[model samples]
Target: MSRYQEMAVFAAVAQAGSLAAAARQLDLSAATVMRSVAALEARLNTSLLLRSPRGVALSPAGETFAASCQQVLQAVLDAERSVLGLHSDPAGQLTLSAPLLMTPQVLLPITLAYLDTFPEVQVVSQARDGMPRLLEDGIDIALVVGPLPDSSGFAIPVGTVRPILCGSPAYLARHGRPATPDDLRQHRTVAWTSAGYVTAWRFCHGQAVQWFKPTPVLSCTTQQAAIRAAVAGLGLTRCLNHEVHRELQDGLLETVLDDFAPERLPVHLIYREGRRATVRVRTFLDFAVPRLRTHPALNG
Candidate 1:
């Protein structure tokens, strides 16, 4: 068994908890993964993994080896990337993840344009509505909105989006428009709970911050679902300015309480620490950030 190949396979399995997930990620068969793991264990003269009915767990030996393998494997990739002619040209697959709503609002357009510019690079997009650990999930880069939890990683604040209080014209007609944070309490509201709290909506004018807890008429796991419910006139909903920019422009929805809009929520492009900032990733950020700021709806 090739030592480097074994290291790569072990690292893949460690990153992906299941053999099936590792196989799919590596574009290999489950049998191949099993064989590689077996070969590695034999060469090391230690059982690295404990297989059971539930799933595979790394033994103490495996835990020590996995971290070393990741470091070694990353060094190898870095060396190869440095020498590879296409490395400077950014010719490789880039895996990205973001919230479901941001997929259409921000990432999709940038990805489309990126593909057009770098035909040699393939972009794979994953929708992770809930916060995802970039390294654990094997995501090359992640676009995160709102504040992030404590983690060891690199974050680039590319831009920000302001939340807009909006609803379909029909819904506003029925529930009445909220002119201030206090008015939201009497209005039917669509709540998006997957990202964070549903009942609390914050608004600010100058230094004063006021929060409102609306009577949620509908709740959904995703921002997209909340926006959809609002579009269908189920209830008033709030979302990032970019999420409903086109809809508002096309007269599908209308914004209310713009004067009392909340502070700009941060948008970030984050990646694991020490992952080489590839030329492709840098290029996309350079192009996308400036354009995103100019977008009429987003508040930079």
Candidate 2:
């Protein structure tokens, strides 16, 4: 097999965690997939995967090699897309990543519109609550909310979202709306947690910021789940304005302590810096930026 094919198979196997799974994904037999990975290891003169009946686990070196393979494969794909851009109509697959809650509320609409406008383009979107490594995840673009740390991507500001503390009308009527950030202590809360620990709820008053680490009556990993919990009259939950915009509009939820809400979080469409923009990416960005900036939820 060609070096590129070998690397591609290796990367596929690593991602799939089993030879049979990778074979299924790549439309090859399990033995062929195993042999390709084994050949790659022999050529490198090092053990890459620790094979077991359950699946294969990448060794430390294999982990680094897989990352490199992904980058190389991505570069090849970019080159192909650039060449294809010479055509009149853009036609290619575009992968995107964004927060889980924002996907349905915001990104999905934009994607559907883009698809309708560009018949030849296909979209593969992944939504997760945690930050995704764009390169590692093969994401062409990422819709990120809140402050961003130092990165090599070009962040284009599309809009802004403010965190809102809200709960169902029934929940608020029973527990009473929190008059201040500290007043949240006395109310039941639906909290978002990461790694089994609840994250602190942050609020602002003028120039001062405060945090409340409430013992949640219900804890969830996804913003959508917490919002649902709050809407079910379980307790108050904190979420981005856009996440609960529909519920708020439908009177299923009501905001509390709006005066103490923090400054709006900047929303950004981030892509790798110094990379050639594929026609699909450029077209989608041109179509999406303005719509997102003027979106009702973000504006309100």
Q: Top lDDT: which candidate number?
A: 2
Which TM-score value belongs to model 2? 0.78
- Enumerate clash totals for all models, in the order shown: 1, 0
lDDT for predicted candidate 1 compared with the true structure = 0.79
Cα error of candidate 2 at position 89, Å: 3.1
Worst 10 residues of 1 by lDDT: 291-300
Residue 76, model 2: lDDT of: 81
Global lDDT of each candidate: 0.79, 0.85
Candidate 1 residue-wise lDDT, 1-300, digit = tens? 489988898888987988888999999999999999999999889999999999998998987888778756755665687786546666666778988767886678878987898887788799876577766665768888888777827777767788888999998888788877887778788988865556678888888998887668888987788888988998888788878877888888998999888878777777774456666667666766676666564553
Runs in model 2 deviating more than 4 A are 5-39, 47-88, 195-200, 210-213, 273-275
Residue 17: error of model 2 in Å? Answer: 8.9
Clashing pairs in 1: 160-300
